[model samples]
Target: MKRVVFAVPGSLDTPTGGYAYDRRIMAELRQLGWDVECLDIGDGFPLPDEATRSAARSLLLEVPDGLPIVVDGLALGVLPDVAAEVASRHPLLGLVHHPLALEWGLSAERTDALHRSEQAALALVREVVVTSPTTAKLVASDYGVSADHITVARPGSDPAPRSRGSRSEVPHLLSVGTVVPRKGFDVLVAALATLAALPWQLTIAGDLTRDPNEAAKLDASISQHKLAGRVATPGAVSSERLAVLYDSADLFVLASRYEGYGMAYAEALSHGLPVIGTTAGAIPDTVPQEAGLLVAPGDVAELAEALRRVIADAELRRRLSEGALASARTLPTWQQSGAIFAAALEKLA
Candidate 1:
């Protein structure tokens, strides 16, 4: 049997898009007869302390030589020295969801350090696998990885039943993502506040623990705009509850500052929900204009205007819904994504 080790920083069951992609692809790979072992390297990655670094070093030392090992970018990008040491002994494959340097709210020095470290670490890997073509380009241009050595295995969306939409007089807007600066929940809240005159309710479902301060800021913004009754944040919901939210929502929206692939946008499309998102990162590539409206990141006026148009015009919503359903049909399945990911690793082996 072909055996490989998948190293990650935290629990495999984290509710974020990257973790979800990793779990789904790994499970699918196992079904395809590959012996995949998951190794948790502990949390606080990409900014790991000495103890965490030592733990990672020890864990890697125990892996058998010449094994094909795939490391998540979160841990791999920060461990250039470790990657260099292991390159000669193992076929190291770097799985990059996005560059760590692209993360928001970082100091210039920190960003430069991360960029340099990731560039050095990625150079030692046998190959780099990214989740989107946008990310592939970023790796090639910013990280200096050769185009020929990189592969794109985009996230796959599950087939979903068409949303029934809100049966109420007021439309329902759903946004799914962690309440972080990168996810731009603050921008979404600000834009929604401008549309208070319109008849709509907003629900943001995501992990509040990822950034407690940001969550608090979002709550303050909602209250500042006098939207306490109209806006509800139930924190992160289970898959079953998220499915219900998608099925009953009138539209899906997220003003993320950036995204590697924007899996939630794809998920919205799968449910035939019209999208309103920013043109940052891979969002424009993932959410086509026909199925959604795109605004510049942090452009509150444009976002509010787009939301108003979709909410007031029933015909527009219907047309966009059709477009979403059509677009969702073109997305790859998890099985296909797994096969592509498997092929990339196999090439290195």
Candidate 2:
């Protein structure tokens, strides 16, 4: 049997797109007849203490020599020394969602450190797997990885029924993502505050616990704008509930600062919902011009203007909805993603 170790940080059940991609791809690889063993390297990764670092090193050392092992970028990016030590003994494949240096809210020094570390770690890997072409290009250009050594296996979206839309007198906007600075819920709230005169309601569904300070700031902003009655934050939700939200939402919005792959945007398209997002990262690639409007990240005025146009013009919304459905049809399925991912791994074997 073709066996490999998939090293990931923390639990596989985390409610995040990256984790979801890892879990789904691992399962699919197993179905393809590869013996994929998962190795959880604990939490506080990319900023691990000495003890955590030692543990990760020990775990990697335990793997049999010459076996291929896939390491999640979140953990591997910060462990250049450990990765360097392991590279000679095993075939290391890096599965990077995005570079850790690109994460939002980092000090200049920290960003530089992560960038250097990630570049060093990636240099030692035999090949790198990215979720989007944007990231593949990034790894080649910024991290010094050769283009030929990179593989892009985009995330897959499930087929969903088109949204019936909200019956409320006002339009219902839905945003899904963990409440982190990167997700830019703060920017979304600031934009929505400007559109208070319009008849629209918003519900943000995400894990508030992921970043409590950011969540608290959002709550304060909602209250300060006197939009307490117009917005809802339901925290983390189940897959079934998220599907229901998509079905009922008039529009799907997320003003994320960056995205390695905008899974939520694709999910919105699957439900035939118009998107209101930024032109950050891979968003423009995922959301077509006809399907929605994209403004520069952190541009509150532009976001508000886009929101106003969509709120007042039902015809424009209809056109975008049709466009969304068209775009969704072009998205790759999970099964297809698995095949691509399997092919990438098989090459190493």
Candidate 3:
């Protein structure tokens, strides 16, 4: 069995989307009888200091020479020097969900730092595996990584858990993602304000980070729109609870301005729920045309119309729900992700 080192800067215990992706990938790889070692490089935030860089180097100390390493772009992109050193010694492949420079809400200084880090990280890696073609293009164009060196591997969703007996009163409109500016929650709130008469409840499930001002803005928007009764912002829901949310919801709306990959959109589709999202980033790739409606980013009127349409037309909902579920079956499983990852490793190893 080949041994592969998977490095990232987040705890496996956290409920983050990147961590979730790593966990799934690790499990699938292990099941295939590959030896996988996980390394936490610490959170790649506010730029890593000297201590963090030392810690990263230390974490790599035990990794076997010539073994293939799968490095998270988010983590490695912040520590370009460390990445370069590690890849020089071992066969390193980058697993980029998206580039940090393209992330929303980043300041010019941080973006510059991220771009520099990313350029360095890509320099050290033999190849990169991105979650979507959109990201692959960015890697090639932005980082100057050759197209042949990048692979696009999308994710699949868990099986829909047993339905928590359907609710009859209100149609559930669910949005699952971190509550940040990138998610376009403000736009969603504005759109919801236009549809006060609809008997639908919008549930926003995500972790609220350290940004108090952003949180305050979201809170104020909810209150101002008088959507306090209609919209519920439950911070950091458990996966089991999230599964329940998916099962219970009548529709899923992801008004994200951009995404590396819309994993929640796949989850919603797997649950046989129709999705409504903007044509941003990998959303258009993840959400099948038959499963939902796609609109321009920040288009409140279009979003409102889509929401209204989903809520009022039962037949349309049923058709979309069925189509989404059917379309989801065609998505690649985690095991496939593992196989693809292993294949990438094979090229360098």
Q: lDDT by residue for model 2 over 1-349, one digit each (tens)?
A: 8888999988998999999999999988888898999999878887899999999999998998988999999999999899999998998999999899999999999999999999999999988899999998889999999998899999988888999999777999999999999998889999998887889999999999978899899999999999999999999999989988988999999999999998999999999999999999988889999999999998999999999999888889999999999999999999899899888887775
Q: Model 1 misses residue 102 by how many Å?
A: 0.9
Candidate 1 lands at a TM-score of 0.98
Tens-place lDDT digits, model 1, residues 117-167: 999999999889999999999999988899988999999888899999988
Any residue pairs clashing in model 3, and if so which? Answer: none
lDDT of 3 by residue, 1-349 (tens): 7788898776876666777888888888898888999988776453667888788888876687888888887777776777767866888888898788877788999889789878877888898989988888888888989998898877756777433324766788889887878889999999989989878898999877635677789999999988898889888988778878877788889899888888988888778888899999888888888999999988999999999998888889888888888888888888788788767777885
Candidate 2 runs further than 4 Å off: none
lDDT of 3 at 339: 84
Q: In candidate 3, where is summed lDDT lowest over 10 consecutive residues?
A: 160-169
Q: Cα lDDT of model 2 overall?
A: 0.92
Clashes of each: 0, 0, 0
